[model samples]
Target chain A: MAINKLKRHIIIFVMFVTLMPTGTAIADFAVIVNKDNPVVSMGKSDVKNIFLGKKTFWPDGSGIDVYLQRAGKAHRSFVLEILRKSPQQLSMYWKQALFSGTGIPPNQLQDDQSVIKAVADNAGAIGYIAPEHIDTTVKALELK
Target chain B: MKLSRGIFCTFLFVLISLQETPTCLAFQIGNHLSLNGYLSQGYIESSGNNFFGDSLDGSFEINEFALTTNYIANNQLRLGLQLLSRDLGEEGNNEILIDWAVADYHWQDWLGLRLGKVKLPIGLYNQGRDTDFLRPMVFLPQSIYDENKRSLLVAATGGSIYGNFFLGNGGYLDYQAYYGKVDFREDSGQAQGIRYLVSNISRMKNLGSVSDFDSENRYVCGGSLLYSPPLDALRFGVSYFTGKTDFDFRVGGRKGEASGTNKDFIVLSVEYAQPDWKIAFEYSEFTGDRKALGIDIPDGRSQGAYVQLCYHLYDELVLSALYDIFYADKNDHSGSKYADQGQPDYLGWRKDFGLGIRWNITNQLIFKAEHHWVDGASLQLPIFNPQGVEEHWNYFVLKTSFNF
Candidate 1:
């Protein structure tokens, strides 16, 4: 009877391990803005506008500084989950804006840590990072 | 002497640029100045007929180089300029010239202004056509973005106003409205095509032929509107432009004029994007009236379209396929009228099946190869091919580019 009990426990543990590994690969991103930014909550549309250079200033009339990761896992997730654009699509969009002399792409940093630091240093800066990396230097915006 | 000078200047420029840090990131020199540039060369070979400089014997006459600069004068204003040198077959001749120069002012997202030479925002890809690193294929679809009419459609000298309206929920409407004038050179491929038509008209009517001909365009005006819904990856657009052109021809030592041929066009576009794939389609109709010439001319209504699909084979490699169609006259899809005139039926239209592969060798270098199986002779320039025309032909192209 004890041997049967041990076998059942082992089977349950194996099932748990197998199921956990199959969880969705899509990741959620935390949109981070400078702590001093007056805006409290942001919708996905607003985020898109800010990054695409449609919105140039914050509510207080201060110039908004946008930073982004060059291209990687975090960049992909942010574009997919927040901006709803693939990397290729976003590249095309930025190319049009650049060549047309209408707008400039956001400054690209090396990694999430650099993005966080950039936002923390500037009063009007905004960016995104993985959720676990969010800290006190920046405030994770509440998605509407 | 001129070729050697050009080669020397290009070498010096590249040498200087290489000494600086090479990165795709915007290169800033001061508080306001930023720079970007690229260089590309291509080789072409065809199974029949001549294209882009003696392709019947295989040609290496296609190349492009450009340097662009942008200056932020203040938070409200910016200045930009680009100098470009390009050659294709016997055209361009590798002459460096100002491609565009503009001063822009931003008042708000709802309103902004641009003055000077501004690139026309035509169709989906015209404004960004010069950038080699941005496209999946070395050449864009010829149906809508024909190589012969490139300069005529690229940019104009004047002013424009642009804006965007936010509709909420990731939806928005964007637009640009402009008025300007475009220039056409006498030696351009467009001029060759026009000459062919005029000579044919003279032969059929038994009237004097046109020679030493040229054209001038004026009072161009147009606008484009794009709408994006809340959907993840779909956008739609419609654009139209119209202008007046005067064609001057010399006959028997006397100058004759075809005044005010009103030219107009409309294009509709749709694109869908995914993580690893994209699909796009565009349809265009162009019309012109040459009744001012006081002679019978083929109805000047043309239509063209293309459907394209691209798939990412890997992070650095992509494969694309396209099916494009062009009709010289919308009313004569079968070319029967042209056939009645003793010309091949295929001369009235072009249908092309194309496949291409592009590999980004590194951040700064790229290689591309493409092939086309074409079923018509519509785009062929008779002046370049004294040997005659072919109803069916095939061509292959290889290109490499470096960007900094």
Candidate 2:
């Protein structure tokens, strides 16, 4: 009888863990720009173009400086959700562009903090980080 | 022994490079200067015919190395250059060459210009063939990226204009157009292949003392168009090229030229992708007219196609399978008619089925192995397979690469 009761408890525990909501587990990431930039909101297509080097300059005539976090879950999420590309596909596209002399990839940083710092220091810089890390030096753009 | 020594040196260089703990793959001297490079070494062996080296006995004379630099002058301008060195059996022979040098200007998302020696925007894989770390397989499908005629299709010295247009509803069109001339050298494998084809045609026509056949490029111009819809991961493209060449033939110590030889080709490609699996297919056709050495050959049409599938086994490992076919003459799938004219029938077409596996040792290091079972000899270079080719053969390849 005791063994039967223990098995029932184990099954309930496994079900509870498996049925939990994923939103609470995964952290929300946000697109960020320098505090001085006038960009208010951006569509997903606009973000894709900017990150892929298709849009070089902002509306105000300053160059758009792009930054990226080195390969990680956040990087993968940003590529899939915003850029609409798989990580491997993104890497392959960059390699082709680099070798063919068509364009260059964005500057890559090691972590979110580094990306935030770089974007904060540059006037027209843009990058992405976890939502909780947003501070006064950078403005988080709303995804449309 | 000489080949083994070369392999040793290549491995030693890779080992030494790995020991250095660099801050980044690219060197940043200032705000605008950045440098990148890559190196790869490969070994091939075959059961009957030779490819890229004395592969029948196994050799290591296949390698590729390149260095690239980029300068960002301003928001609208960028300049870049790449120098390449490569060897493939008796082909490239470790020759240092300029791969590409271009000045690119982007006025907007819809318009851009590239001027200088630029890579030919052919099928999807031509521009990245030498970059081993970019793909999961050691060699691309030979039917589309034909190794025998690389110089004829790889790059051009001239100018190009490209752009992307949004079609609304998540649809887009990407287009590229180029005008230029390709460079051909006497020592190139394409030249040797052309020489062999000319000699065979002359002999068949009973022309006397035909020798010293040389080829020169006149001009080439083409464009590629690709469409992508809002669909998950799908793309379709069509590319076309038309060019003219002049060949000089020496018959009985007399020089004669065949001018205005027209060459035209088209390729259609389709690809579907997901995070872990991808499928692709491409079909191409080449048509041209040949006349020289007091003999006239009718307009010849050839076709090649392949279907490839790749699956990621692990996060860093991939497995692939491909079926490739090439027909020297689309109308004559069987070489019986050509054989009746007193030559080998196996030259009519070739069919190959291949399997490959690749492992990413690190983001910067890669290892790959592949095997192929082939039937027919239509694409084999007669110079390399002088001992004659077997109708059916198999080949194996192993390669390693490191890039920064």
Candidate 3:
């Protein structure tokens, strides 16, 4: 009878752990721009175009300086979710643009902190990072 | 010896550059100018026929080197130029030539203009063929992108207008329209093919041996449209080109002038990509008319198509497979009518199955190997193969490339 009671307790504990709520299933990354920029929100397509080097200017007629992380979870999520491409595919796309003399790829930073710093420094710069990395120096753009 | 020296110098230069700046994607000369280049060396071997040199005996006469520079004057204007030197058997011969020099102006998201020597938007991959790292296969589908006709089809000296349009949930559209003139070199494969044709015609017409062959492209006009659906990694495209060429040849000390018009050259393409796999299909048709010495040659339409699939086994390794087909005359798929002539029936058609592997050792370095089993001689020009061509043949190629 004591062994059976211990088995039941173990089963109940396993079920409770499995049923516990995780904060959010998907980790959310934030797209950021300089605090002084006029842009507050942007559509997914607009972000895609800017990263692709197809959209060069912002609404205020200033050149947009795009920044990206070299390789990280935030980079992977941004590429797969927003750009609908793998990191390798994005790299190949940039290489194609370079070789074809079409456009230049954005400057790549090593980490989220570097990307955050880059966007914070340039008025027209834009980048993405983990939401926890967001600070007062940069404004997080609402992804439409 | 000259070829060896050229290869050595190019290899040494690339090695030094890589060592100096292994991580640089492009060397920046200043605030406005940036430079990039790539070098590729390839070896080819064949079983039954010569290809891209004396491939039957294992040829190393395939290589390419190019340097491209871009100067961004402002947010709206950019100037670009590329100097290229390549050798494929008897063509190119490692002579430096202008691949493209263009002045591009971007007005807005939906419009742009480019003037100067511009790369033609033929099928999907023509503009990127010079860059070995752009594709998984060492050679693209030969049926649609015949290596022999590369010079004639690569680019044109003219102007182009291009644009991209967003379609909300529908997708996006990219369009290009161009007008230009193509320059054909004397040592080019197109020129050699023309020479061979003139010689054969002379023999048939009893006009004696033909010599002093010259050809000029009068003008070319084309347009291309590509659409990407809302679905991820799916695209469909169509391209059309029309051009005319004038040729002059001396037959037994007599000068004769002829002209050829390419009417309704069209290509349709589709490609789909996933994270680890991609598939592409393209079909092309060329309808043309030829007149030689005021004698009308029979008009015919040629057709070509290919289906390619690529799978990435790892982040740096890719495997590709291809099935390509070509016909000299779309109406005579069996080549029975072609056999009525003296030439072999296989000359009228070609069917090929190819397999390739590409390894991206680094962001700036790549290596590739491919083999093709061919069942016809359609694009194998007689000028390159005095030893003759067999109906069943195969070829292998190994290539390595470095870029910065």
Local distance difference test, each candidate: 0.78, 0.79, 0.84
Candidate 2: tens digits of C-alpha lDDT, residues B1-404: 13443554465466446556432335655778877777889999988787666899998877887778899887778898987777788777766677888998887778899999888777777778777777668778887787766777778899999989878777788888999987886666666765666666656665657677777888888988888877857889888887877778786577866643546688899998887888999999887676655566653688899999999898688899989999888888897755877767887788989999988777677899999999988775456787777778888889998776
On a 0 to 100 scale, what is the lDDT of residue B14 in model 3? 64
Once fitted onto the true fold, the runs of candidate 3 whose alpha carbons sit more than 4 angstroms away are: A1-24, B1-21
Q: Estimate the TM-score for candidate 2.
A: 0.90
Q: Candidate 2 docking: what grade?
A: acceptable
Interface RMSD of 2: 2.2
Which whole-number lDDT from 0 to 100 does residue A17 have in model 3? 91
Candidate 3: share of reference interface contacts reproduced = 0.49
Regions of candidate 1 where Cα sits further than 4 Å from its true position: A1-28, A132-135, B1-21, B200-212, B259-262, B291-293
Q: What order do you get sorting by TM-score, best first?
A: 3, 2, 1
- Candidate 1, residues B1-404: lDDT per residue as tens digits? 13443774576376546655465444767647877677888999987667667998998888777776788886668898877777888887777767788898987777889999888877887777766667778778888877877766778899899988988665888898889997777767666666666666666666676777988876678888888888867889888877776677875456766644436788899988777788989999887565324664555688999999999898578899999999988999998887998878887899989999988786667899999988887764456776777878888999998765
Report the lDDT tens digits of candidate 3 across residue range B33-146.
877778899999998888877888998889888777788897788999987888888888888788888999988868899999988888998888788888889888988788
Task: Please write out the lDDT profile of model 1 over residues A40-136, one tens digit for every residue.
Answer: 8987778888888878778777778888787777788888766767765676577556655666566778888999999999998999888889999
Give the candidate order by descending lDDT.
Answer: 3, 2, 1
Off by over 4 Å in 2: A1-27, A84-86, B1-19, B22-25, B201-214, B258-262
TM-score per prediction, in order, is 0.89, 0.90, 0.91
Native contacts retained per candidate? 0.42, 0.47, 0.49
Q: Model 3, residue A114: what's the lDDT? A: 93
RMSD of each: 4.7, 4.4, 4.5
